[model samples]
Target: MLCSCGSRPDRTGARRLVTPLDERIAALLLAEHAFAPATPGFVGVTVELPAALTGRHQLRHGFLSPRSPGTAALSGPPSPGLEAGIARMADDLDAATSLVGEVTPGGVRVALEAGLEGGGPLGLTRRWALAATLAPVLAAAFANSPSPEGWRSTRQARHRGLPVLRAVSDPRRAWAAYVLEQPGRGGPGLAGLARHVDALRPPVAARGHLEIDVADRQPRDGWRVVVAVTAVLLDDPRAAAAVEEITAPLAAEPALWERAARDALSDPVLAAAARACFVEAYGTLARHGARRDLRDQVAEFTERYVMRGRCPADDVLDAGAGFRPVPR
Candidate 1:
């Protein structure tokens, strides 16, 4: 699985507010940190891994770029090493402030893209369906961005304009139709269509690999739990089968995504699916001999949040105060 995180810098004293990092400052930070060779607006570094872990896949690389004037985006594949590659990338971004003044990273947003097992037209269609089915459960389980509007994941609620994937027998035709539906997008042929697809931010985006964009930005190292549980559920054979069955009933629910973002686990149907999926993932991690630390993290998260029908956002909401950065 490939993972990416977006973090905004917190104001020194006002934790809820953010400091902007303009493109010039971003470029300078990239150069000072030696996260090269710089692309148009992004700087990246190659992350070396043991051949045993990488197998046939190429060495993983991490990228840092400014998502907006105030937010930095860090992305990389999951690390099989001692530390996650994304964490290291965040560290570099936190440390380097050569051109820009000192700034503390805050409010992380994470996305994980899982590659299809085998390449085929039918496989692509099935993968799209699976991603769509699992999106709401994952979103509800990991919800963190709480707002006064009563939504557990305000960030997700704001994505109403983005497309939602539906279970389709022919994803290619569906995708083509989706693209054409957008104004000024119909004229794009194959190459242009590829670019258009890259730009669209759907709950589940098909970019060869299925990009799951439902989860809110996790807090501090809580991101590990998000990555571990998601990877295990999607990549493990037994867990995948279990989740497919667990999420089947959710596909037909009207306004499921809206419910997931607003009510989170408070919704009975989503709560049950999330509970079942987490149980399956926890067991799969143990049986598959996943790292002890990762297994422990998942177990702790399941106990603290999933089992109780709560999420990270509940902690923030219950605190009854403005959002504060959790100690790293």
Candidate 2:
């Protein structure tokens, strides 16, 4: 969520507002059966709902979640006990502090259950593979962090060039073992998976679900773009093929992030590939009978970003108030 300073629009006031607002939001979501921790940086918080609502309602809840940030989840099987435990944890964390990390200018994460139509372990693996394949382009499209002091773009800029995790491409059992075995969570099992779910960021799979953590704090319109891009890549083989074609060559570039982060669409190759994916995604969405508004939003995002070589971060930078220098 964009942390606005209300009438007191300066930086200091914004910082002051974060703590009080974070605390208040934490309380409110608990009252409403949501789990959230008071975020530590910037003036934002994250409330997580146990289930995915319809698109508009989910966005509404996300808006409420920051106080709420748009840290929403897509559909998944019900997990009443897990939800309750998280809410309890959130309550404990809220009583302790109002600091949540990664509260940058451009920060948002939307997670969808990785389970696919076939409904089994293999289905889950397929879902993970698809998300892994499209992670880079989605990251580029949704890059929104740019420092006001002219420090290029994306707060999590490290994400741009980071190689895909080895586990993403491994066989299904291997992927499950990797996630289940991560030491910090616990000894491998359902309990371990639960502990690590929130800890592990998206494009990650655990306990039979996947989360796409590629987006950032975007304009409301950007949500539609994210949904569209995800649907096309995961559901449409043709679009995924096009995206794979584009990103395959980058596996060996020493500083590939420079192209995705600093240069963005300004890089000719990335631009061409991004546009192709967008076009193919649009067509795929159209044939699948997606809503007219959704199709248009995806098209608009494509033209505005892929074709024009601009991203949400560029708009933020142009606004001047969108960022501050990274703290040392």
Candidate 3:
């Protein structure tokens, strides 16, 4: 699970705009704190992961990037140690920005990547399809970025015009065709294809592992619930099967992604799908011996939001003018 968080400097009682200098200073602080090397450009820090955590030497380093002015993009491998990874990254970010700024509420973005089972080209294609099919449903379930525009996930709404990976019989070919049709002067060579792939921010991306980038930033510790539910639904066999069935009809639904970001659970079809997905994940977490606290958190989230066809965004909307987001 890779997470990106945006923060701003709070001077006195006012929120100050984050500057490039502030980002540089935070990067240096994070590098020193993590004992990692700081680099120029977007990706700022690279921390070496323990072999025990990564299970290999090749996938050793995790990255911390200041891709956006006020954002810290922390990328790492998936669970069983993903929660700890997120915690460490969060702590590093907090320590790094203590003298400069604080992580903003609703500014965290997450990308959950699942490895393809029975590793092969076919497995890769199948996993990509599954991730694509689940993207909108997950987005609706976890929508958090509320705004005056009346959209549940303003972050997701901003993804309009970006490439969306659809369920296809041959994803590899579809991806190649999509890349070729991109309005760029990029070459048709392998290097150019690589560049195109790196540049596009599709809902579901194939990077060895299938990465789902749909959920909005959760509030406070709510990110844990997002990761746990997403991980369970994709990783657990039974849950994945159920999710496949639940979301199958969504393929025929018009402007599904738009509906997911706009209406969120207010859309009856999406609400029904989210409710079932959460239930499946809740059950899978228990049967798979997940931590008790994590299970409880998922249960609480489901009861408070999913079951009622609401999400965290509703809380912010409900608060109206007096609304104060959760503090970092």
Candidate 4:
């Protein structure tokens, strides 16, 4: 049934609703990071951990920075439920910040910060979980910020562009005429309301390479790689032997990304892997009984995980550069 929404609704309850296929493709991104220490290459952990990102930079270069941070929301079935969910989400973000102290005391300081963003799917709980998913990604993307006093940045990330771009076309926005006939953020101007979304924005690149405190207590200049991992639940927790067994291998090979580069150069397996993710994502969308509203969302993530490519949403902010966000 279309329910009250002009379009069909997502049948799965938000929390229990991730598609199995998405979990599978997400496994690959994690595998890359897992492979980092072993294969003589870099392995990355992409999470929304502001502290880790901040700590690494502070220790290394005497400053901190964020690359690009993203925000996401899941719309629930209706208004009442949505409000409750967002309140809970807001509370959680506040709580998560407390963990920041752990890294800060250990020589390198880590600061974890959280904020609210806008434009959710509809329901509050669903949007809350989507927001939860985003937390880790924001952490992972944490990059360069200047010093103890956050720098004055002119850099703008596209996290703003995603919700704003909706101005051009969004069926949900098109349907807003019915929802917001009243006042406040209530009108068909949900498009305008979407404009009010928090848009988890991140700062631009570093002024220069920052320093990190090394074993000698000396400052070194270099960049830490941010690895984005997905689909942790897909591989039986242990079957991710591919990712699990890589730390040493990556260090051994030292240049394994060259193989990833080769995938673009000639390896059909790369495309095959990406194609498989798209197919699986579409299947997951269909299986979840969402054949339309979820298409763009799923496609964007698939590109991020499978192709190591930028999504249209991400492109709106930084073209291809801003994946990590560190608070300036």
Q: Point to the candidate with the largest lDDT.
A: 3
Reference-based TM-score, model 4: 0.23
**What would the per-residue lDDT of candidate 4 be over residues 181-281, giving only the tens digit for each residue?**
32333112223333222121221100011011110000111111111122210111231232222221222332222222212212343334334434443
lDDT tens readout by residue for model 2, 54-80:
333222112322222444322222222
Per-model tally of clashing residue pairs: 0, 8, 0, 61
Winner on lDDT between 3 and 4 is 3
Most accurate candidate by TM-score: 3
Better of 1 and 3 by lDDT: 3
Ranked by TM-score, the better of candidates 3 and 4 is: 3
Candidate 3, superposed: residue stretches over 4 Å from native: 1-61, 78-101, 104-122, 160-166, 183-195, 321-328
The best-first sequence of candidates by TM-score reads 3, 1, 2, 4
Q: Could you give candidate 3's per-residue lDDT for residues 1-328 as a string of tens digits?
A: 0112344457677765432323234333322221111110111112211112211222233444444444445454333343454455455545434333444433333443333334332244445666677778888888877666667876677554443455666554555455445555333333444455566656665443445566676666676677667666765556777887887777777778777877889899989989999999889878878778888989999999989999888888887642323211
Model 1, position 215, has a per-residue lDDT of 65
Residues 1-328 of candidate 1: C-alpha lDDT, one tens digit per residue? 0111244356664334223433343333323321111111111222211111111221124444444454554446434422354455445544334323453333333333333334332244455566678878888888887776667887567554343465665554555455445544312233444444555656665443445666666655566666556666665556666787788777678888788888899889989998999889889878878678878888898898888999889988998755533211
Q: Relative to the true structure, how large is the alpha-carbon lDDT of every model?
A: 0.58, 0.49, 0.58, 0.25
Pairs that collide in candidate 2 are 39-99, 39-100, 40-99, 40-100, 65-68, 66-69, 114-210, 145-154
Indicate the worst ten consecutive residues by lDDT in candidate 3: 35-44
> Arrange candidates by lDDT, highest first: which order?
3, 1, 2, 4
**Model 1 regions more than 4 Å off:** 1-60, 77-122, 159-166, 182-195, 323-328
| Model 2 per-residue lDDT at 295 | 81
